[model samples]
Target: MSESALQSVIHTGDGRTLTRSEFLSLINTYNWFLKDQAQLHLTYSQQDRDGEVTVEGFLNISWGVTMPIRLQIQDDKQTPPSPLITPEISIPVSPLESKRGMTRWGEYSDLHQIDENAETPDIIISNVPPAPIPYETTTLRPMRHKNTEQEAESNLVRCQSDASLVKMRRKAKTAAQREEERQHRFSINGHFYNYKTSIFTPTHGASTKVRITSRMSTHQVIEQLLHKFKIENDPEEFALYCVHQSGEKRKLCNRDQPLWERILQGPSEDIMKVFLMDREEEEVSNDVAQYLNLELPILEQVLLKLREEESKEIQRVISKYHHQHRLLSNVLNCKVSPHIETSV
Candidate 1:
């Protein structure tokens, strides 16, 4: 922690302060390493989470918002196994530590019961270097070990790396890759009528949308919906029933298109529903209630999303055509330039 960082900052009620980046660096190193050591998460106020990252992947600080940094230990290595931390907290294994090597002090070390040849990674907290003391005291100060020196170097390397946006090695996107990304990530105006024979929740509400792609088959859509609802039931046991506005119901096969293109060609008012009925059931019961009022609000939102999707698609097409035209003009210019040179 640099004291210079405290010049423009607010403090908690108990009078503690550290930058967001500094706090993350401290906890994610040594005894509190979530990814490499303890395998835990760092969460903050209102159930917001931090450190959802991999060893190679990057995580950055939220400079706009900061949270308090008082460490709280919920579990500890104990005999009886209570929820609180024991009086003596066990030192977590550091990544740089080795199982080999011996202590410089040898027999005089407090841990004389153990073999003197083996090295211990932990250090006495009291032996930490003094901060501008008037003079040295009798209390022995620990000198830098090989492991400690290596740890400092490793930290220096990590600190040199960018702690804001992540940088990655990637190639240029192909047309197919761009299309796939747009399908999966970009939200659009889409409506699915779900006729349900079984209730998912007691409070009746319209969860009007599911994440889907145009190329997804009926089976994939069913699997996605089941996973979204946290249903453990096998996907094979269920089937989708497509109900036409004219009340014509048809069960779609596994390989069939989940969103039937033909059905989508119908007028806006001629809305159809896809029922997630059990395969064992003969047919959907007429009593499965329909609440058009609740659905109308959702349908309106879908229309708005659809307009945004169309606008985006139009822009993409226009850009693609412009790029093609530029290429074609370049080719023509190259051919014409050679012909003029021959004539000259």
Candidate 2:
């Protein structure tokens, strides 16, 4: 193999360079051996013009496989080049005996040939009963004794029964607590309103009377309003604000705080007016458009009602005008035709 061809194969695929020690270690670890008959031939006369020296050798591996290897070493003064090892012959080692002759069974039949003419003897025998066969039964012992197993099963059953009883008791207690909470009413004057659906009217015309518990937070009430009004915008864009009877507005900052805390801050007679407000101007505009889109059906119904009312009013006025015109025409006809009738 030429030096150029070996260099091409060495850097062809992963571009990996192996040193002399690493190359020898790989071959030795893989059980590859060099043949005693193979010899490494070196020609000192072919050294490069520079201080570089090239050594050529044949590496004999197992199964009579042989590969040509080349090493380029720099002079002691010059920096060494990256060492690379490349095999000239890439063909894998093949077995020595690839094919073997197979023998047929019939070819050896003559060695075990039977004497057919020597077996002509005749014999007669009376009928005999067959001997009875006996079977031995083997018993298997349980890993745990029967009593112990019964006791374990009973204990498991008792534990399961106790667990079920405890669960039932807990459920009953929770049910009783829930009933008590349902009966208990936290007295607070508050109204729930959504800004997205309400449009120009923030409170939706009039505030609603709501029954909320102390457990309910201002955040939860706002969430319920959003859900009730079917507001499609993000909940974070809206917040709860309290409007006092004194015409002062205060935004509810702590949403996680309980509703009772908010109720206690305001005047006693004045109802706590809580309404949803948009956090951002962009969100407000977008939500207003969305709300208008969602209220399209209701808007159409309202338009239909207004048109019906206008039509009814117009009909009533027309009927009144017709009644007055008929009276005027009757009076004119009676006065204008009286002379003619009298003359006739």
lDDT of each: 0.44, 0.41
Q: Highest TM-score: give the candidate number.
A: 1
Tens-digit per-residue lDDT, 96-178, candidate 2: 42243332333322322223222222334459776785544445743543488777677763444333444444533443345
Per-model clash counts, in order, read: 2, 0
Candidate 1 lDDT score relative to the true structure: 0.44
Clashing residue pairs, backbone N/CA/C < 3 A, model 1: 189-305, 189-306
For candidate 1, lDDT tens digit of each residue in 1-344?
A: 46564343322212344454544454345224334533233333221253222111111101110111111111222223223434353355556655654324333222223433333455346767768844545568755335887777776534532211122223465444465444332111121112242222212112233545434567887777655443446777777665555545566677665533222322122455555666654543333223233477887887799899999999999999999999999999988884434553
Index of the highest-lDDT prediction: 1
